[model samples]
Target: MRHFSSSATRTSRHRVIGALTAALLCAAGATVPAAAHSPATPAPPAGAPAGSGLALTPPMGFNNWNSTHCRAEFNESMVKGIADIFVEKGLKEAGYEYVNLDDCWAKTQRNADGKLEADPVRFPNGIKAVADYVHSKGLKLGIYTSAGTRTCDSVGIPGALGHEFSDAQQFADWGVDYLKYDNCNNLGVDAKERYTTMRDALAATGRPIVYSICEWGENKPWEWAAELGNLWRTTGDINDSWNSMLSIMKQNLPLAAAAGPGHWNDPDMLEVGNGGMTDTEYRTHFSMWSVMAAPLLIGADLRKATPETFDILSNHEVIAVDQDPLGKQGTVLSSDGGRWVVAKEMQDGSRAVALFNETGSAQRISTTATEAGLPEATAYSVRDLWTHTTTNTAGGLSATVPAHGTVLLRVAADKHWAAYPPAVELALDGSALVEAGRTAKLTTRVTDLGRTPATKVSAALTGPAGWQVRADSATTAAALATGRTLATRWQVTAPAGTATGTYDLTLTTRYRAPSGKQVRSSVPFQAHVVVAPPAGGGYLSDLPRLSASNGYGPVEKDTSNGESAAGDGKPLTIGGQVFTKGLGAHASSSVEYYAGGACSTVTASVGVDDETGAKGSVAFEIWSDGTKAASTGVLTNDMAAQSVSADVSGAQVVRLVVTDGGDGVDYDHADWGDLRITC
Candidate 1:
């Protein structure tokens, strides 16, 4: 029963037609109540625990969301089987509890007594029977409902809306140990008020059920859910994919302050073993969730879970970080777009650090103990959580993380070494601009921040395929003194027949720490390498290879104003004609081209791109060696193409300038099509 915002497109939905049909028919035969049964004021039974106090740590359990999604296959037998497997497979012993159900279990309508009932087909023995069975196994039972008038998957069952008290009492009477309250079909009710009502209702029931608020963070539950529920979902539903998981993680990283003991900020349920991600990616997902102190709710089918799934889910080392007594959610200390270092402070003063690589290739990620809150220059015993290996070191730690993976380590201060790792900072220059068939010199500066000399320094460059990238300086050098900067340079030559496109280059540097251990760090740099296209043939995206200038708005490339994509994916279009580049911005945008005396006559079709409507005026000017050769009077943003030519017979350079015609630039998308220079 997952729902996305209106701005988002739904990629998939839970297919539970059979369950909905049965529930709907049952509701059709049941009676409808005229009024909701709500108490005038919510008053909890004596000795009821506060919502925040219910979950002292992020709850470790399993939910049916990702696996079944309330499909017809989700029934009493399936749930009981999961509970039995949890106990039999030692998951229960490993602290995995709470067999939870999502939506679609309830009938469409309430009984004559205004009590919601379970669908006979899916739960013939009713919810209480299932709860009692779960209790017999020493486990807990969880149920789901919506905060809105109808659930997200309201094909059959209605929502709690005005029946908060009655529903909470029913759950308590049925011995439900947990409730996953959703926000679907809320009918515009204020999220805070509606969720607060449920919180009070659960409290009044005198039951110690774990309350999970699922509003998809629309109303910012973390800002106010501290007293509203034990845990709160802080993002939309998670899909079983790498991008979805990473997006959720990115959104949750900044909300760590809103989480702690009792009130955990949940980033949806886990998707490990769901067959949508690789084992390495699953490990990254699990480790990140644990590091962030998010509730560990496995959403895979335990009945068919692979051994790898069990291994990742049962890793006690990672789990301990999630359940640390300090209750501090980890913080992202540093990130380079794809690589990140997240550190959590433990109660024992040791810090748990996760070196994460979100890229598609393995990368060396490193961080200092000081940056992660560990004492600087102090010897520490490092424990690799994934491998369970221990090492003693006083310097910083580095590890090669697999693609979409993490290196989780627990650091405890030791007194063995008096030395520290050389603090190294890496910098690169001339990584943004490159031309084909030419060798570009890239300069790298590495500085040592520690008093100890960094020994055996080396650097290497990895460029695109078919490209030759080599270091001009000696790859290996003698020890570098403290506070000294080692300037390493590399020359990269693009192939003579290389294609025109942006390429990624990686620079890796290795140096020995003060502890005499080799450490490595990598930084990614982009190279916009361009090769001249055949006469009259060029891509709009490649226009940056020449020169572009803007006085007000951005220089649009091969695209309409305000859009990232070209109007029809064409390469050339101008004032309205065909051109190689579609450059546009607000006030003034211009481009310059000098083909090294390759052409004497510059011809182009200029006009506004068809996609841009009439909004502003732009005048095009052609200059040769600082002299005006031709000018296209002012042209408005209309879908019409105009032909313009300028003779640069003996000019050394040719320039094209577009300016807003005396007025502010708004919706001004100018294009140059079929531009060419002929000698």
Candidate 2:
């Protein structure tokens, strides 16, 4: 295990801001403002189109990890079925087009030509057939491999490392459109070189195979992935659990600006509709993925999806946000108390926002569009994507967000709308509005999310694109007046037909003295744009296609029959579709379910029989991957309709395996969903 050198980034808390800057930079969608970037950035590639935006626009597709079914053999029918389902099920309608095959799907070895072969058993017709099927459906096909000589599988065939050109040719021959080059063996400095090697190699193939480096966040892909590949994984494997998902999402904010039309930071795959998580949890999962602008690869049995699953996967508005041509991935603006408020700016000047409650209890998360510190005075229309309706607020003038879910709002200020710093408030002297030829005097207004004003801020801007600064100054920020926050009298002149695009002036300021740590924030120079409209598109993952039933909560409810759950009837539900069902119940209150292969649909129910004094509760849970799938208080109920029954849908690594601790209770019914397959 190669260790990372933390000493370098330790001094600076490489937390959220870094991620935000990256997302912002990439959000420019194909047009990278190299001049606007921090001077510390390396020079742009020579011979490459100068300032041309990302290679790909409106990156489309779902990843396999979301609905991946590995280890099990997949035939042409299965592979073709995926394409048909993707189109028929409306994943493509949601703007997703990539049908990525992750990890496996390869033969045990590559040929002497260095061409990787598909598992013949799984592809009786061949890899070309698979690609053709995907293409016929108007979707692109992506394949996976490791950057190391031998992959994480240890026996993975030699990939593009040493034979980059050969591998690229093989992929091109196979009509492969995308490559997810994972980092398995090589670590540290070597890992960086390997990815770069493959990147250059793929480029040599003459065909544009979108490069996706999957290194699991070893090196700062945010710092380099864009230059080398179209997309890169920011973290390691993401499972179908809430904890795993959150950890990866929280670690990615600093990389937001780096994502754009072509290059994206992958957060693994979608675990929704996978039979392990509840629909609500899946909703949260989809919201987070869309907000992050991540690749939506589904890993589930698509053949078994329900109609509601189709609806969730086919949501247009959500897909629009994800595919927004602007391609700026949303970052975590604020998070606290098991509640997080994340947001993304849309091309239409609105934002796709989400309010998530990770805890079990219902949480009220209130927020203002201003609190998240986006453009202000802008009008917003609140659309509840899941509820499929518009949210009613006191005023449509702005947005008021609620709890447990998101109010996907569209906010648009008049063309005159200007962005403000949330923590600082300034009174702009409007005389700066339009000076025929003279430079206007601009000022700053900033306030905290709480609306408290901030003052005496320092601001700086890279010289205007076409004009040299009238005042030759770089050592000090534009002057800030007392009782004022920030001010700059720019003698800037616009070039004829300059096309008036939004110019990002890196306004660096140290507004106040440090209380405990140094703080700095950047504000982009805002001006009305007269250029072409921004790009737009988004994607929905595989999660929306599965019927999830349970959101397992609390354990140890009623009377215990044994160690396992012995409910008179229904068992408990966890996540959503996953249920902890009981086998049989003689009579008992509390029942214990040990973790095992049967945690799929762990359901618990308690009942009282007049003849057989059964008066306890049934407690069962899915424990796979060493964690409980879902838990709940004793399942005791008089009404049969109210008896607990859960339907689990995902958790690829940990199959639900429950045990019966035969106590006083024998669960009348207990079962789980998405049962684990053991060879």
Number of backbone collisions per candidate = 17, 141
For model 1, what is the C-alpha lDDT against the true structure? 0.70
Q: Which residues of candidate 2, in runs, are more than 4 Å off?
A: 1-58, 65-69, 187-189, 373-380, 391-407, 413-679
Point out where model 1 deviates above 4 Å. Answer: 1-9, 12-52, 416-679
The sequence of per-residue lDDT tens digits that candidate 1 reaches over residues 1-679 is 3221111223333222223210001111212111111112234454333353456778777888799876888899989999998898877776677889888889988899989999999999999999999888877888999886667673857789899999999998998878999876666778888888988888887677788998877667889888678889887678787756875787688899998877889999999999988898899999999899998888998999999999998887787788776789999998763579999998778888999976544455788777888877545656677766455444566665655788887876655323435545455742234567888777776766444677888877798788888777766667877556678777888887666555778777788876778888666555666544346534334443344444322345554444322232334444444454544433345465544344567776776555444455677877775578998988876546777888877664466777666653434456666566665
Taken over the whole model, the C-alpha lDDT of each candidate is: 0.70, 0.48
Q: Say which candidate scores most in TM-score.
A: 1
Give per-residue CA lDDT, model 2, range 1-679, as digits (tens).
1111111111111211121111121111222111111212232353332112333443455555445445454456766788888888667665666777766577777777667788777777778888988888887787877665544442354545566667767777887777878665442337667777777666665555667777767667878767777777786566565544654665566578888876787777777677666666677777777778886666665787766566666666565566667678887766654457777876656666677654333333556666554455433334555544332222221221221244344433333122222232222222112212335344433222212233344545443566433433332333333233334445455454554333333345555421222335443333322221112201101011111111111122222112222232333332222223222222211122212222244343333222112333334453333245555444443324223333433322222222222332222222322222221
Give lDDT: candidate 1, residue 133: 96
